[model samples]
Target: MMYDVLIAPFVEFEFMRRALAGVLTLALGGAPVGVFLMLRRMSLVGDAMAHAILPGAAIGFLLSGLNLIAMTVGGLIAGFTVAILAGLVARMTELKEDASLAAFYLFSLALGVTIVSIRGTNIDLLHVLFGNVLALDDQTLLAIAINATVTMIVLALIWRPLVMECVDPLFLRSVSRAGAPAHLAFLALVVINLVNGFHALGTLLAVGLMVLPAGIARFWARDISTMMMVAVAAAIVSGYAGLVLSFFTKVPPGPAIILVTAFVYLASLLFGPVSGLLRQMFPGRHLEA
Candidate 1:
């Protein structure tokens, strides 16, 4: 009776398994990306790239008739192209990195909306914004696994140089020629993780996944390695909690997960033992005193 009433709903459900898998994969890959993004001070780029994938996904849907894999591929290509163009524009002109990213993402957002409207397929625009995690299938799960593996491997290989560049770019550049390659490779991995994660979390919240936990971790730890580890642990725990909540409550997984993470961020912000808002706000009073 317990098996029929309780376990069956989650254990036998394909969508539930797929949604859990999606959450796990994205949290694992995105946690490190979040740390490096913080170090680079280019965290906004993740948000911009996430938005940039919209038009490509919409276009893919229009052409391929809603094949999620094909549409995701389209989004991935579009996202990478935007990143490349933004980098080139930033290099060739004086617009600066933030400005270039803004321009690219804004243009992509407009183009995506226009194309979807013209296609007249009755597809909801909000799906691209918030994502539909419950709709994830085996094929999408496989794609996410592949993307996660590649992202983790690349991150592991480039971890040291990336850290050096983040801390002391000039010194690293003066010391070794490999810093430039490491920087480029790291950006490439960010693009891939953002695109892959978009399948579950969409543009708005996917970027949040890459920023909020890391930001929260910074409040508690002084060491970069410790901060990354803490952020990953936080992400994995909150992700699972969100998935289970969504499964039981019939809420959308992406927003539910992000909302949970946001709560964690808020707690960290206000009460983290090291550099919390409360400590900063009331410098004189101590919890013991």
Candidate 2:
């Protein structure tokens, strides 16, 4: 019965296998980036970036009608543009990145909606917004896998500077010339991951698999490494469980995966070993910090 519930879906359908693979690649890159975003308290900015990619994605959709390569490139261009513009605002002007991100994403969201309304039906717009994970092709899967690999490699290369920047940006800036580049590169990776994630999860909710696991991990883990691992593990579990549930229940796979992570977040919120709401019930029982 358990095998039928869990393994049968993937074994019975090629689409299920593709869906699982696609989300797995997304989680590989999304998890660590998510942990960092949470630690840096850039959750809102990250969310905005996800939404801000919509206009480019919409343009791609209009140009190619659900071509994965075109839409991904479009999303990448849009996401990176916003990140760079936001960073520039933070650097040159007095406006913060969060405010800049909010403004840009709102405009982009409006633009995307307008374009979609003018060019396509409401259902097409929904497909862009929510994605068609079951329709992922080999090319899309390969793109996601390549993005995940590149993200992991670049992260390893800049891990030290990133950690330093996160912990003590002023100190890192004073000590090494890598601080600014590290920050920019990290943002670039985020954009790339979001772009890839959009292919499976859509522009609006791509940040779900990324940010939610990180939030859940924060309550359970003390250090960054542990948090990242936990986040990835949680994300993978969510992907698997959500897929299984979706196969049986006929819910949308993308949002189901995200909902699984949401459930973990709720569990962590109330009963985590570290800083959970229920922790107060057992005073002085803090986990390793």
Candidate 3:
């Protein structure tokens, strides 16, 4: 039963294997970014940025007509544009980060959709919104892997300063000038990962792989490093489970992966060690006394 359920799908079909590899690679690279975003209280930022990638992608479609490289570059540019603008808005105005992000996100989403609608067919737009993971080819796969590798390396180099910003921003500012640069660099990484992610999960769902796992890890792990590792593990597990479920149920792999991650997130919310509903249920016996 197990073999038929899990092993047979990959062994019997090359696309299944490729699909598994694509999502697993995505989770491995994107999960850590989600953790940091969660820690820094930028969960919504991922969503906003996801929408922000669309206009660039639409522009790419207009220019190259479904050329993968063009769309990716366009998406990267659009994502960064919105991210940088949000930062500038926060820095210069009375509005907070979330508020600035909200303003830009809505505008960017509407703009992107309008651009695509005016220039693209219904099928082309659908591709932009939902993505086609099973159709991911060798060139796209290589691009995703390369992007993931760069994201990890840059993140490691900036980890300390970035964590400082998350924990105690004022302290970081007082001690060093790296705070602003770190924030920008981190935002860049977020944008790049989201662009790469859009190829597999689409603009709307790409953030799930990053946000849900990190959110789930929050309840299970204490420190930042542990939380990141746990988040990656959870992402990989969910990705595999999601792919298997997709194989049997005929569900779309992207949404199936998200559904599995959603379940994991809900499970953590209910029974996690740190702040679960189950922990709340027996509060008297669970005290630190």
Instruction: Give the number of the best model, judged by TM-score.
Output: 2
TM-score of each model, in listed order: 0.89, 0.95, 0.95
Candidate 3 lDDT at 119 equals: 85
- Candidate 1, poorest ten consecutive residues by summed lDDT: 120-129
RMSD score of candidate 1 (Å): 3.3
Residue 96 lDDT, candidate 3, scale 0-100: 89
| Tens-digit lDDT track of model 2 for 1-289 | 9888989889999999999998888889989999888887888888999998999898988898888878888888888888888778888999987888899999999998888878899998988888878889999999999999999999999999988877988999898999878878988888898888888888888999889999989999998899989999899999888888788887998888888889989999999988899886776845997
- lDDT digits (tens) for residues 1-289 of candidate 1: 8565445656888887778778778777888889889878877877888888888887886787557777778888898888889889999999898899999899998998787777644445666667777787888788878888998899889888888888899999898988978887877777777777777777667776778778878888888889888888888777777777676786778888888888999999999877898988877655783
* Cα TM-score of candidate 2: 0.95
For each candidate, what is the lDDT? 0.80, 0.88, 0.89
- Candidate 2 yields a Cα-based lDDT of 0.88
Ranking by lDDT: 3, 2, 1
Going through the candidates in order, what is the number of backbone clashes in each? 0, 0, 0
The regions of model 3 sitting more than 4 angstroms off are 284-289
TM-score head-to-head 1 vs 3, winner: 3
Query: Which residue pairs of candidate 2 clash?
Result: none
Span of 10 residues, lowest total lDDT, candidate 3: 280-289
CA RMSD (A), model 3: 1.7
